[model samples]
Target chain A: MSNLEQKPFNVREIREEFPALRQQVYGKNLIYFDNGATSQKPKLVLDAINLFYSKENANIHRGVHYLSQRATTDYEAARQRIQRYLGARKSEEIIFTKGTTDSINLVAFSFGSTLSAGDEILISAMEHHSNIVPWQMLCERQGCVLKVVPINQRGELIMDEFDQLLSKKTKLVSITHISNTLGTINPVKEIIQKAHAVGAKVLIDGAQSIQHMHINVKELDCDFYVFSSHKVFGPTGIGVLYGKEDILYRMPPYQGGGDMIARVTFERTTYNELPFKFEAGTPHIAGGICLGKAFEFLETIDMEAAERHERELAKYAEDMLDTFEGLQIIGEAKNKTSVVSFSVKGIHPFDIGTLLDKQGIAVRTGHHCTQPLMDFYGIPGTVRASFAFYNTKQEIDTFVEAVERSLSMLK
Target chain B: MNLIEKQEEIIQEFEVFDDWMEKYEYIIDLGKDLPKITETNKTEDRLIEGCQSRVWLDSNFRDGKMHFTADSDAIITKGIIGLLIRVLDGEEPKSIATADLFFISKIGLQEHLSPTRANGLLGMVKRLKLEAIKHISAS
Candidate 1:
């Protein structure tokens, strides 16, 4: 029963699970290094999608019909699956959302109402726009102060600065577990403990970390955790917001609609309980069910070994790319993940990205939804090649060569 | 040469380059020949912001003809701009606005027309047509 994968983590066999990997683009084998944006779904998740639409297509809850009951059962089962996956104590803590952005917006609108003027919400410099913009909107509405924790040149959060920023006035600390652009693995456990000492709730954006490693919310003991299913090889438009039971109960309902209401009356209406109170509209039933299947696919793999493989890929890529004369790796964090982002001295990232695309390497070249981080680095954007466990060292070799060729062309 | 003759000439030139690499090398050369707008004209107002690259377009209406001088931070995008300006410039506003731009596809560079393309050739084409429309409506 040890999923330590004693068989030594066969990536070739693992790559077979994803049909997308067995494809050609631009007359060459496709090299997908854009896992930071979204991951390709395994056949298990894909089949679940087909099964849901073909047979299990029905609106969940409130329906006494056979299909509706079946759908409701499947949908609730998915929530429980996610709850157990995150090591959440109760299923009531899991709230299905549109994605990570929607989950953050939900907390911003519902829990944000609890804060008054001059209350501070602390966030880090490397947070995606999804994490930053919602809190900014919350601040704008409530006159709350937005305090930013700065990062070092290496893209690691300055713990000293974070310590100085955390205070009684700080109501919340929302930070990313991993930077999407820089691949910096933030120390969220330390952050959570520090934030809690000052009576501040911490929301860890797990959009980057969930698929890469084993996440136990009970162990982390954070107030809230949010991630997109799409980034975790699940269906798009469905995500999970894991909040502490007590905190979720204290926050008001996000949207008033069918599923979220316990009772509806023009004169007086009562809201639903726990997780249902936050889930307002008719949910993406297929997406919810298929995401559970995505979790099932993940369970079959040894995530620890996979994480090791990804880290090795990052190291190999970084070491190879560092040799170029004018090329500078954007983030040099000691503890990082699978992303290797770099900028050439004079060449624009866009031009390099274009040539790479023609060579059948799918890379992301832009600010990567971290404009403030880009501003801090004093660069317009970077060419980011993010790796997954299925990616081989051979592919990195090809990718490095492509980068070299592209840089030569651009220069 | 008229717009049609010039497009045929460019298409013929691209036809010789059998491979994408050769085509790109030629385009990179073409980028060097792009009629660049001066730094003063490269203001925020002239910027056509793309998802990846930045483009600046300078439009002038002279003698009933539409003249465009544009620049892009990315050389590939600049070369594409060069191609657009080659056929459209010196043509009347009405002709330029309605000109069927078939050469981009004929030259096997239609991928740039995709909205997802970082160079934002689709946006450039739209801005170019928009420039033409401005002069057409004025008259």
Candidate 2:
């Protein structure tokens, strides 16, 4: 079916799917603009959570009992669901972790431990601490050098610089596919191609990318892609680390415990196969099961249309914020997701955020765990208002009005 | 070590947090009371990196308990740092280990904090806990 031929998503029907959207905060209908951090759960996802605990709440790959068998089936089914969602060739490529932070740490410990001294790991300056810190730790321990590809004033990566950084010593090229702070959509396909030209492995931090638009891992051909479930309208405590089978098979287990082992002996223990090798302890069963439903919920929507709507909202937000005197938008990327970052000249970002919260509009104000990016901009922090498809133009209007009210206080 | 006694003590202190305006007013006043750190202590090494406000924390462990003296460039932040020292400074290493500091919710401070400031508080607490953990492990 053609992408245009697809039916438009029913916003009311979709809004009904998320019960939390109907909530009242401070006697006003809650305006949730924090979708970049973590999205609200849909009814299907929340219901799946309840259903799993009520019916099939048993540990996977353990017992011959009916519940255990059922649980194992559901759990593996969730992996397959994710595989289809990301367009991965095989389900075995998916390794579930706590969140994006845990997934990055796994790669750092498992694959990064193999990197020797003088090896270089290249990452972009726009990466979240989750993406940057793990590699920093690896560099510190292994003596592997850490290098960053710089971004321009508009928050876009300098492609030529990134190419120059990728050389024989470059072991890995890890970068965020979409910058959380700046809303800059990076060229991952081009990045992967250039990195591979030098025989370097590439890992795309999809924590911000997955929600903005559709992704096909097979098409990108990156060595690995990582994302958090909570950011994609699923529950917390679960994330996916998607790597090609051969790569995953070569990597060592991150954490050793009950489930990750194939055989246990005081003398020599054998590790479990593929994905199980990475996932240790009793898994987040309910969270994993609900995440399958969240993926299903997203799949039913018209992603391209949703992307267009978000872009429209972002443009409107930007135009509105531009009118204020001494107000500067932090990232003016021509291509962006639904995030708007700005700083007021005289007022502190915290004071602006606090004043906005009085009008029941929640916005994030800080370095956003991107300290290096903040330093690059030479600003303390920016007030960030991120939008989702479910958000409306009216809400944007409300947001702008609140900013005007906040400006009066500053003056 | 008695669970009930500890719970009662925590609860008693926790109740005073109502009317955050009043509590924060008192806290800001307390911050005002602090003698500002000398210019020599305000170097890059003293600055806590993740904080929204410039917080300088220096500690002395006396008789097996950690004593932290902290100040921030922002007034309310300085007050909160002072409150943190009052709650955390004299506690045993193990007591600090098992502490349910998420009770920032119960005390209504969590709601008052901008997510960033809440994150700052969390970072502050985490740093303090790590110091206690280090002390416990070394001993």
Candidate 3:
């Protein structure tokens, strides 16, 4: 069925599923617009967390007992569920990680070990520090070159510049699918194709994209995709790293520990198979199982409606905020998601954020870990209000009124 | 007034405001009344690291008293620094070094200036006392 023809979903009903949305903060109704930082947990996700610890608590993978076998089954089932979620060919390609940061670091260390001095890694200007630092450390250790593809004033990646940066020397092109700060939906599919033409691998950071839109690894043809569970309305400290099986087979194991090994010997220790080889130690069992529950919750929602609702909330906020004098919206890309970042003239973003917090409106302030992007804009930071499917137009109105009050007080 | 007496006085003043809004307005007013530090004094040596806001503190020791001048990029943080300066400035280095400045919690500003605030009020206080220690030893 076409996206426009999808069945309508009740946003108010969806809002009720998230318990955090029904609360008062500082004598005002809490308007949480910081979904870009981390989404609020639904009741199902919360229950799953409790159930795992209460009823199904045990170490996974190697236990032959009932609880161990049950835990192992649940954990592996989570991997399979995530595999289907991302449309990967096999469940073995999904490697459980601590988070997106841990996942990227795994690739940087494992895949980076194969590189020599002259190999280059190309990243975008708007990458989070997680994506940037690991590659920089790799460059420092292996003497590889780290090049950044710059963005335009609208926060969109410069495709021509990306094409220029691509070459045989470009061993990998690591970029974010959506900018957390800018909310710019990057042309990652096109980027993947272009990078592939030069025989370069592409790693898409889906930390912001996984929850907002549909993701298909096979359709995108990306070599690697990484995202955090917390950002996708799941438990923290668990993430997924999807790598092509052939490429993963070539890379070395990330950490040396119990589960990632086949046999331990005095001289030589044989590593385990594909996914477990990278996952070291006893993993976050509860986090893994609850992540499956998160996906199950996601499966119940009309995702197309959720996406449209989020976009509508953002546009409503943006339009209202634009009417306020001296307010300039940052990252005005043609294609964007549910994030509105703005700055008022002659007022600091911190001041606005503080005032907004006092009014029970939770928006993010400062550079948001994208200091380089802030430098490009020639500002210290912007106040950002990011939306989720559960957010409403009434909340946007409340937020805009709060912003107006804050601007008046500050100005 | 003595340091403890001054802190108690500030706490009593804050007690008049029942709502956080009024209290924050009072703090913002205090921020507005703060004396701006001279541009030359905003050197790297005078800057406090690990603050979310940029805070520059300058001190001079005269007649065994430590005179402090400070400024912050954020207003609320400036007000906090103002409160710190009010209780400690012009005191003897020994007194400044040992003063507890207990009014922060009494006035319900513990969250804003606590060690975990990340706005670096705790670090600023530590640096101020360290300066006092240096002055006391020098004297």
Candidate 4:
């Protein structure tokens, strides 16, 4: 069905699905704006967690028992669900991981071995440490050159610089789809096409983008896409790494363990198939299942409306905050998501965060794991208010007032 | 005043503030009043590690007592360091090392000791006591 033909998103009803929103902190209703760090779990995801532990508790894949078979089915079904979610070609392309960090490390170690000295891996300046460090380690190991595509003052990537950086020596282009700190929605489709034209693969970090908007790997035609489940209203400790079938089949196994091996003898051990080869040991079975439930929850809502609601909330907060003297919004990207990071002229972000916490408002304050981005702005950190669809305009009003009050106390 | 008496004084002072805002205001005032650390002592070696905010602490042993001068990038963290120095600055190495710091909880600043804050207050306390221990062993 067309997005317009689908049921319109109801914020009030959506808010009801998350039990965490009904709580009070410091004698005031909690205003959660830390969705960038991790989103609050909905009832369906919670129920899936409980149901897996209560009824379907068993080891997967190897066991022939009833509960074991049920668990394996659920686990594999979760992979298929994620496959459909990302519009991946095959279930084998969706490899369950511990989180985004682990998934990136897997690719760095496995796909990275294919690279030799003098080969280049290109990444943007606005990448999270998770996306940056793994490639650094890969470069250090393989003696490869790591090239950085710098961003402009507005936190948008300089496509001209990226074009200059792309060359035959460029083995891979790993970049974030949406920056967690700046909320800048990067042009990954263009980046992927450009990278492929230069005989280079691209890995899109979807940790921030998966929650904010729809993503189809086939449409983007990225070599790899990675995201954590927790950031998308699912449980922690489980994530997905969606790689192209041909690329994954060619890459070596990440970890050695019982599940990842097809045949093991004292002399030699042969690895398992496409997805299993990457997945080592007993996985986060319950977390994977519940992550599937998180996608199911998203299916019930009109994502277009949710995306619009989040953007409006961010714009509303940004406009109100701009009116205050000495308040500088860090990122002013033309294409952005729901994250609004700012810093007061003279006041430290920590003090503002402390006072806002006392007022029962939750906002993330610091470099936000983007220390390089902070350095680019010539600041220590920023106070970031990230919105979700469940958040209301009323909450934004309360937040702005709290920030003003906090600034008054700080100044 | 003795260390315990000093802590009691702080508790009494905080009790006057009925809300977190007033308490925080008092802390900010304390931060403003903190004695500036010398430029030479603000070296990289003097900087305390594992805190959310950058804190530099330096110590001197004089007349069998430990003198601590500290500063922080964040004002609230600076205030917290001031509170620590206020109680332990002039005490003997043994006393400074052994004395329990009860003023933190009494002033409702226990949240600063949380893991999310990276247990920065506890790290500061540990560093201070370690300095005291070094002084005790040196002389």
Task: Give the DockQ (2 decimals) of all models.
Answer: 0.69, 0.11, 0.52, 0.61
lDDT of 1 by residue, A71-142 (tens): 999888888888888999999999999999999998899899999999999999999999999999999999
Residue B17 lDDT, candidate 4, scale 0-100: 83
Residue pairs in candidate 1 whose N, alpha carbon or C atoms collide under 3 angstroms:
none
Candidate 3: give the clashing pairs: none
> Cα deviation of A106 in candidate 4 (Å)?
0.5
Pitting candidate 1 against candidate 3, the one with the higher DockQ is 1
Minimum summed lDDT over a 10-residue window in model 3 chain A is located at A1-10
Q: Residue B13 of model 1: what lDDT? A: 88
- TM-scores of the candidates are 0.96, 0.80, 0.97, 0.97
DockQ of 1: 0.69
Report residue B19 deviation for candidate 4 (angstroms).
Answer: 2.2
Report how closely model 3 matches the true complex, as a DockQ value.
Answer: 0.52
**In candidate 4 chain B, what residue range of length 10 has the lowest lDDT sum?**
B113-122
Counting clashing residue pairs in each candidate, in order, gives 0, 1, 0, 0
lDDT per residue (tens digit) for residues A233-334 in model 3: 999999999999999999999899999999999999999998899988999999999888888778777888789989998888999899989999998999
Enumerate residue pairs that collide in model 2.
A17-A43
**Stretch of 10 with least lDDT, candidate 2 chain A:** A1-10
In model 4, the clashing pairs are: none
